[model samples]
Target: MLVVWDSTVNIYSCAVEGQEGLHSPVVCFQVKVTPQQFSAYKTLTCSTTCTLTGNPTYIWYKNGQIVTDNTSPYSVLPNAVDSYSCAVKGQEYLHSPAVCVQGQSCNRVTYTKRRICVLKGSTVDMSCTVGYYSTTSTFWFRSDKSTPEDLTRDPGYTGRVKHTGTYKGPFILRISGLIEEDSAEYRFTFKTYNFEWGHSFPGTTLSVTGLQVKVTPAAEGQKTLTCSTTCTLTDNPTYIWYKNGQNVQDNSSPMYSISSEDADSYYCAVKGHNGLSSPAVYGPKTTVSVSPSGEIVEGSSVTLTCSSDANPPVQSYTWWYKKNGGDYQSMTGPHHVFNQIQSSDSGEYYCEAQNEMGTDWSRTINMDVKYDPKSTSVSVSPSGEIVEGSSVTLTCSSDANPPVDKYTWYKKNGASLTGSEKTYNFTTISSEDRGEYYCGAENKYGHLNSSSVSVDVQYDPKNTSVSVSPSGDIVEGSSVTLTCSSDANPPVDKYTWYFQNKTFQNGFGQMYNISKFKSKDNGHYHCEAWNGRGSMNSTALMISLPGKQTSVMNAAVGIIVVVLVLILCLSGLMWFRKKASKSTSDTRHTADNGQGDSSPVYDNISGMAMNPTAAQTAATDDQDDVHYASVHFSRAKYEEVPLYSNVQLPQPQKQDEDFQYAAVKFNLPSAAPK
Candidate 1:
């Protein structure tokens, strides 16, 4: 009978029932996998060379490791390069020969080692195996940064890193002259036609360290010095020992025996790399000196040199300088030189000499450079618009090695001497203080004079007055020009002409012209001078007409006297005519009353020869009917004397009687009211 079991069992044996001391031999059979060159994700079947006892299970192995336990057929989605095998239950030790999955693309990477450690300054190689369907490119990068960067392009790895091998292959990354900063995880990445390998995969990690010599007590007053490293050196490199700057031993063993009483410095290095040796246990002696042992002057060449006595010689030198108790500034090199030294170059200086073993500092030295005064200048405070009555200050400045000891102030084309100090101040500035000024700066070596600067004092218009052209009298109908004058720092910008209390015209300059001077032009006239500072009105000047205007007034008065006499003569004549008419009316009334007839009577009167008594008698004699006479006068020429009057009588009481008329004459004044 046959029996089957799971593939987990490594060995198998059978015992027959009711058979005493009888057992089947423990057997092992080789498991064979069908389809040796199958594609990825293809199901595979496992069979044994010899038949098993019962229904048996199968165990699958990938890359020499157990993956799963199953019966007969096994299903897997495999990487194109991973190996696979199967085994029967209870016989895991005797499994089928491993077979790799072929064809059928998949993306995968496998590194040769997970972690590596090596000595600094030594070259290292990291390798990885890659699997892909169709690879386009592959590269190696460090995974230490937030983003993976190609090692070949890194500035720190320039000229020290290289990549080798094919796209889908056992790729190699070689780096020479490794440093402590090069310790990081490195990964290999490849790009296929459609996919890229994921960066999440943990890559190989590298740690770089320096070499050290450890001394321990040994037998018989001797000590064993061992060259030590943090990790085992690659390729099992030999060690080299140095004692007091001399090579002592070179061998595979890292241990060296030395006498305990020896007072010598010791160091170590790898056999092939002698330049990258360890630091010596002793310190170096250092000293600093300057060139030109005598007095240093400005613009002279000066240099500071640093010296050290070290086992491996100093690899780097740094010069430090301090001035006026300030912080030290560092400069690199064995010698610090100043091509043209200045007064500012004076300071205390020292140097530090360093090697791989230790560092040494030199004693401080003082440098002093003497020079004359230079860069002399004058500066004014309150830069713009120096107004009158405002305080102002003028400062003198210069650069000197021994410092300026004397300062003298001067004004161009001025007679008075100013103060002998760094600054010249004005308590209350005036227009008289405005002028070009300069200062003299003197030191122990020499003296310098600064360029002149102007102090323009701004003020309101002053001494403002108006002057008329032609000086004395302004004649009527003559052209006249009035000029406004004022004293100002910035000059007058505007001029305004005023007549009496009203502004007549605005002008940009001083002169105001009147084309025709008339009587109306005579008045109190003044002008206003204006500048940026202030405005001022000039004193009023009287503009009077000349003698030609006075004669015109006298002639006007004579014409007025003739007109008044003519008016008086005409008024007297009217009053005499009215009195004559009243006297005639009274006489007529008396005649009519004596007659008692009440009939109208006609009377004729002519020639002023008839006296008033005669005119009354004539009216009484005509008692039958008294009549009043009306007289008519005629006008005469001024040169002639004709004063005549005509009187006509009314119709007589008898209708057929002829009409009667009368003529009258009067005396007239001669030269009618000249």
Candidate 2:
């Protein structure tokens, strides 16, 4: 605020910011003038303020005399060289500072602003104040204006410019649709009836321009990007920015800090630019990244990408791969893909991005591939025949990337039995546990199984046993076998069979065969297993009885003897009847029917005496063949049973030594001839 006391004209003017709102006054009150510098013969104005409100009416005094205006800016000209002061209408003792204006009388103007910049296609206000005793008309125009045309009514700026302040305005020129052509020093002009004035030397300078961006690298990880214009538009211009064409509303500074992750195109503009942005610019460098990253095993796929910020948009990308101590390989694409990657594909990889504007190379990236375990194997602790009641351990092994996290053990017979540790252990091995065994190794990727290994348990025989078929009361003529067996490792070496007499019955093998069995073969039997360790005998077995009977002979001899005895008894009875008949009747000579020359002898059994030792009937003649004779003897079983002897009487002494004969006949008694 400026105070110009012109004692010559007693005029006051102020060039100050408008105080539209009421201010809270402290202990004291202040007053000022607008357009403090004034030309001579201009209308003099005076104003006053105090520590009071309600739009208080003011009392004006010129050189200690009461002035008559209730409104502010009481216009008055100093008819004489005097001073002016102010006080409240009723409270005149509370006086204000006096302003004594004195200067050369002339039409004059002063711009409120010296220089400014505005955005294109926006509205702007240019203001100034003119102080002249008779300044009835005033206008604004640029410095090169012809005839100093009024900016508000000029033909070239007709629809775009107007006076915001009233017709008597300390001129405020409002212009819309500002353009670069509108940027220049603007002056204010005023006409005071006869004299005209133009003030251009201290006019306000206007500037209009678009935005631009620049990038620079500060440190390894940080980059600095600044947004600027062709020329400075305003004293303090706040900036707005965009990343990948998205507004960054939080950033209000022209410069921004960036890192490797911020690879997108960036642009900025001044505030109130209607979202206009500078041409996009890439920051410090490109960045390279691989997908499916981190400790991947072999046989998996991976993708790599190269990214950067560029002006003309990235046009081409090239991928480079290299192994340890090997040459780099190049492939043209934005991505490098590894499908079913293998160990030979492991290496360092990088990429380059190029455009019509520029080119950049990204930092190297490493891709590791993970896979399931392989080359799996299982091993036993002692590796050979296992002894019973001895400890054994089985270990599983495999190769994997991202090393295997789990191992499972299984014992295999016909089926699988599972356990959770890498090693399976047995405190004491038994015959029941001998079989094929294997293990499975696993990780996040997959699972693999080890090859199976078999175990052979060596043990001494226990609980030896022997068994016999067709055991008891077997039928004859059936074959039988006795088998010997035992529970043992390395098998039983020798099998021996024995009988009840404690003699070795069979020696060749485990079985004793008895084919076409006989009674002598039936007996108690047992077997034994003989080996290097020790020998064990089995429980006894037996074949008890014969099966069936076979043959029959002596009944035929008894039947033949019965028939001969009956014929002899009949002959004796007949002879007896014949003898009796002869005694009772006249002695009829027993005529021999065709008798032979040798007389047949008839024996008389009535006179026969019995000897306990021998009872005999003698044949009187050598031939008794013609006579039927029967001899009956009551015999004691204690005596010699009937003896028949052939006898020749003493007549034959001359022919031969007589064969002795004992044939005696009893003559039959004849009954009456009926």
Candidate 3:
């Protein structure tokens, strides 16, 4: 007979009816469920590797407990937590291995570890097993909030968290350089075509902690140092010891013994993870050193490093420097670097190293950076207007590591003026010295030139003169102009004109014009050119009329002479007429006395100078008539002067008496008598 219990199945030999000491062939079977997946109802089936002797009854069990004694196929409601098995009734002692009802296709998750603990600055991996029908996506997330957030997308875990594994499998979440804030519950989630694994399932919780050294008193002036943590570290890792930043020992024990007088700082770390070490515990001793240790020069790379022997090392370093008697300024870093040093960077410098324990200062160091002159310039003394013949000075200034050894002066578009002197002086500055000037400053390293400065000289007008247009022999009734010119530092601003020692009202400009020149316009003319500095007068210019005017005076004198001659001739004529009148009166009286008997007597006094034929005719006509005088004048031609004649006659005789008169004519010779 064969018998089975809830926990075990046994097989035994029975006395057969005809044969004893013989038993049926041993048999083995396996338990299987229909569809091989979880459901509300499942059918349990049993199968054997070898054939049974006859029709065999079936037996079934659930979770190590009998559910039925005989059945064609056992049936039950399946669950994930229960186990089931089946066997033939006669061979019940050889039952099949127990199997969970829910198979590989169940929608569930199981974390490998419920909780994990790790040291700060170390890496940790959380793993889980997943079961699903057909997963589309899977990821690891932190379950600290109601909404699950993927660790890979979290801001605090960027670049430090990652996920590894396939869908519906053992998934892993790896986080490096862990900190205290990384302590949280981490979960795994997956999604199928229609269903998603719920996030309410429990997940693995992580705890991150830091290491510290605990010092304790010991015998014989000795100290015991233990590398301790807030919680027990994972993997039971070995501890390493460091003295003054140097590795000393590594062992499984966390305690280390040392002398109490040891001044060196001590720290510890895990054997495999030396970078994540405990904080050193000691008094801070700070010092600073420069890299590329030599004389620093301009445009060279330099670095200053601050070192300290402090419990936690130097968390911050501050650098302070002073240059050219100025105030001190600060910079922060473990290393203060100058990518390209300058002349102004030459100064006294020091550093301060600080930690949680305390702070310490380094010794002051003078950084005398050698370089060429910089910020070179030329400064002029008496920066006002530079007048000609005035004393002036030009000084060269620069900033250099080594004081400028040589100074040079230069003029634009000219040669160097001075050498090796800081200042250039001019006792008597002239117009020739006015130009653009610059200075060159030099040291042992290099040389540089400053920007140019303009020197302008101011002076009064000079070399003044007046120029005349239409230069020679100015004629009357013609136009003329006088222009004034002068040489001056600044152009002549005002011009004045003078005519015969008097200012011309219309001559207020550089040019004086005479539209219609007359004799009165001829005189001495001058011009005065003026500027802001002073004024100057030009030499007098003589203006005279031409010789055509002298002929007019000669014609006027000739007319006056002709008028005097005419007056003399008229006076002589008047005198002769008076004498003639007196003679005529005497002759008339004597003739009247002698002429008694006027009808019978006749006097033949022919005093008329006439032509012969005219006189004979007059004598025959009137024998008794007496004529005193008669004058005849002819008409003058063109261009000839007319002559006037005056005649006086006696009183008229009786009206009835006959009076005959003869005209007399006198002819003057064309040529004068010798």
Candidate 4:
């Protein structure tokens, strides 16, 4: 009977020359008499070939007893060397045996290994070593996570090449077309003829990488393409390209570059004797977003929004501020509010949006704010002098939020006046009302004072009168008094006395005494009373010395009579007397007194007796001594005498009127009439 090997055998099946089945009736070796078949000796190790056919199961036997499943072909148990036998499947078991016998030894030909390669677009013999294989497996992989599975074949390598060899010889895999994804480690597994157990060598990492098949712009058709591999190799790589996952013709080199219509998604694979790496993927999606910078008014609130799109979502938003030459600062929120705006608020602003992919910023913005001035000041019309009962206007204006609403008028006399800064009239003016008045303007905030104005009221004196005591002329030396009184609107502030045009006394009440009255003191006198309005004078009065006026009039009349008598006497004596006497023609006579006492010239004759010559001489003497009292003296009467006689004939000139000449004796004293 044929025996099976243990599970440790790596190469469970192998293609032998003319082998088909193991169950065909055949000879069986004697159990003990076969000399413990020492068919061959070999060593084993992990190899890429062991992975062929998805890690083929193997069985090992020692002295016809089963060994535990351990390594690939057999497990000698460390220093336990022994003869072993392996059983495997074959194509023609009727012509050959399914079992191969060998001995495990410390020094044996088991170290010798084989390589494998799969044809393009076909399942690969993963047991083949990469570099040792003359031809590599074409783009094949076992996708099983724990153990190897069925191999995938690349379509581009189909029908291009084939793999043929013993399971132990170089199991090279081959393909005509090269592709970028065809490069990788390939596994090859096989067994020796004498050593029933199969062994494996480390897998050979294949690098069938080639130049990237790239479709550049037609203008750049002459650009060079590059092909490289991480492993060092003696043979230069050959490149074949596929456009849009299809084979490309007329392109060969380690690097194939073209601007042809089939050059889109062009992929070139390297083919020497190794596998290829995966294609480098490069279709990165890129996008961009645009936004406008926001504008902010100085002293006002503003909002800034930033937007962007990327492969990943944006994480956070941030704002940045930029002045003419200042650094940037991050903002918590897009909106900024300032209770009180200042000049510094004016500048440019920007925002930035960030994500795991990248970051973007918005355009700069500008801000502007408006400003207003304060309230206008107020003033009064007539600033300093507002009269009593007179109206004044106070104007109020301002540059505040709201205009002045209403105005209040205040009187300085501790009284509240009317509303509205102006007044129309005072019913009547009185001195009782006069003081300072100021106005206050009202706004949203409070009150402000208008310029102050003052008022003054004037009046005239009333019920005025003047009195002089004793009801007589005021004498210079005697005591006399004057009093002035009045009832005035503002009160009689002062009393002034006037004598003639001179001012004497001034006060509310005055008593003027004439201590010594002189002639000069004799004149019209008056009193004046004054108030705030004006001063007024009293009716005139006279103050004088007693009896002074009458005495002066009498003395003037007496002097007038004495002047008239002296003028007439001197005229008569000079021219008429002597001439008249000489012209006496007919009547030259002596005259006598009629009465004994005296003689008077009268219309009738009065005679006096005396010696004629003596009398005549005496009369001449008397004329010489006495001055004529009046030119009205009657002509002296003379007696008729001889014309030649020297006679005094002064009377004879009057003889025509009186016709009586009288002579007086020189020695007699003159008599007077009552």
Scored by TM-score, the top model is 3
Candidate 4, residue 427: lDDT: 59
TM-scores, each model vs. reference: 0.39, 0.33, 0.41, 0.23
- Residue-level lDDT tens digits of model 2 in 469-559: 8666576678887788888777887887778737574464978788877777766777878766667888776565544222111233434
Stretches > 4 Å off in candidate 3 = 1-281, 310-312, 322-330, 344-346, 355-357, 471-476, 545-674
lDDT of 4 by residue, 1-674 (tens): 23222112223232322553542232221111122235433343222211234344444444233454444544233333344443332311111112222232221112112222322332332223212112222222322214532233434445653554442344455444544455554444332333332222123344443323232334443433334444333334356555556656333355554533321343456454224422531222222222223433335444445554432345566767655456776674434545555446555666666543345666676544333323334455566644444554545554432345666767775866766743424556566655666666666545666555555554576556777777865556666677777756566777877767677744336567665557867767778888766778887765567766633345565455444543554444334345436644422332232222222222111233333334334445554454332234434544433322233333235343344432322223363110
**Cα lDDT for residue 98, model 1?**
45
What tens-digit string does per-residue lDDT give for candidate 3 at 105-125? 455566777678898988998
Count clashing residue pairs in model 3: 2
- Provide the lDDT at 490 for model 1: 92
lDDT of each residue in 518-617, candidate 1, tens digit only: 8877777889999978999999877768654343355566556544543442342245344445556554565556533222222234322334444334
Better of 1 and 4 by TM-score: 1
| Residue 538, candidate 2: C-alpha displacement in angstroms | 2.1
Off by over 4 Å in 2: 1-287, 292-301, 306-334, 340-365, 372-377, 398-401, 412-419, 440-442, 445-453, 475-478, 489-494, 500-506, 516-524, 530-535, 542-674
Question: What's the lDDT for all of these models?
Answer: 0.70, 0.61, 0.71, 0.43
| Candidate 4 or 3, higher TM-score | 3
Candidate 4 stretches greater than 4 Å from native: 1-378, 382-392, 396-399, 422-433, 450-497, 500-535, 538-674
